[model samples]
Target: MNEDLTFLVLRQLQANPKQTQLQLSQAIGISVGRTNYVVRALIERGLLKAEHFRNSKNKSAYAYLLTPEGIDTKARITARFIQRKRAEYDALRAELDQLTAEAEAEGLLPQ
Candidate 1:
């Protein structure tokens, strides 16, 4: 999975650990197979831990949680994600400004 997806999955897990793969897939707009693959990768990388427990509904389920290392990684990745998005936003803002100026110069833009 890409860094963006990894960061998103980690963030989602932090938000709700008890969510099932299907639920996560639906929430994240990814396929169930991709969610399953990502979860397995995280487990193998020691970034996430899957604990089986019986929920209040009396059904066995897995709660995907982050380990200490995972938490630390998540923090770092979140920072990076923020930086990337901010840079993209800045670029878009700059482009919009340029486009507006050009349009205004040509009298193609409304005041």
Candidate 2:
């Protein structure tokens, strides 16, 4: 359960609460089972709420939406994720610079 993917899933649900797990799986490129698992986890965590809606296509199915708590959680998690990734990118760039400097000093690569 990637936090990024989880946030994206929540965002998607926010956009279209009526979208089915099957549809979400297709959109997210994940399996239906994984989507179901994540959705159930979100419900258990009080991050999502589902309601049964009667549409022309399906009468007995439900759709999902983020709870107020879910929206807050999504924002927090997404911000943290972005910060972490940016830090990682910066660290990797620093490491690359060090390696390049070492290589140039050793005459292993062109300056």
Candidate 1 per-residue C-alpha lDDT over 47-89 given as tens digits, one digit per residue, 9 for 90 to 100: 9999887555646588899999999989999999999999999
lDDT of 1: 0.92
Which model scores highest in lDDT?
A: 1
Tens-digit per-residue lDDT, 43-70, candidate 2: 9999999888866467757889799999
Scanning candidate 2 in windows of ten residues, the lowest lDDT window is 54-63
The superposed Cα distance between candidate 1 and the true structure at residue 12, in angstroms, equals 0.4
Instruction: List the global CA lDDT of all models.
Output: 0.92, 0.90
Pairs of residues clashing in candidate 2: none
List per-candidate RMSD values in Å. Answer: 1.5, 2.8
The C-alpha TM-scores of every prediction are 0.92, 0.73
The runs of at least 3 residues in candidate 1 whose Cα sits more than 4 Å from the true structure, single-residue gaps closed, are 55-60
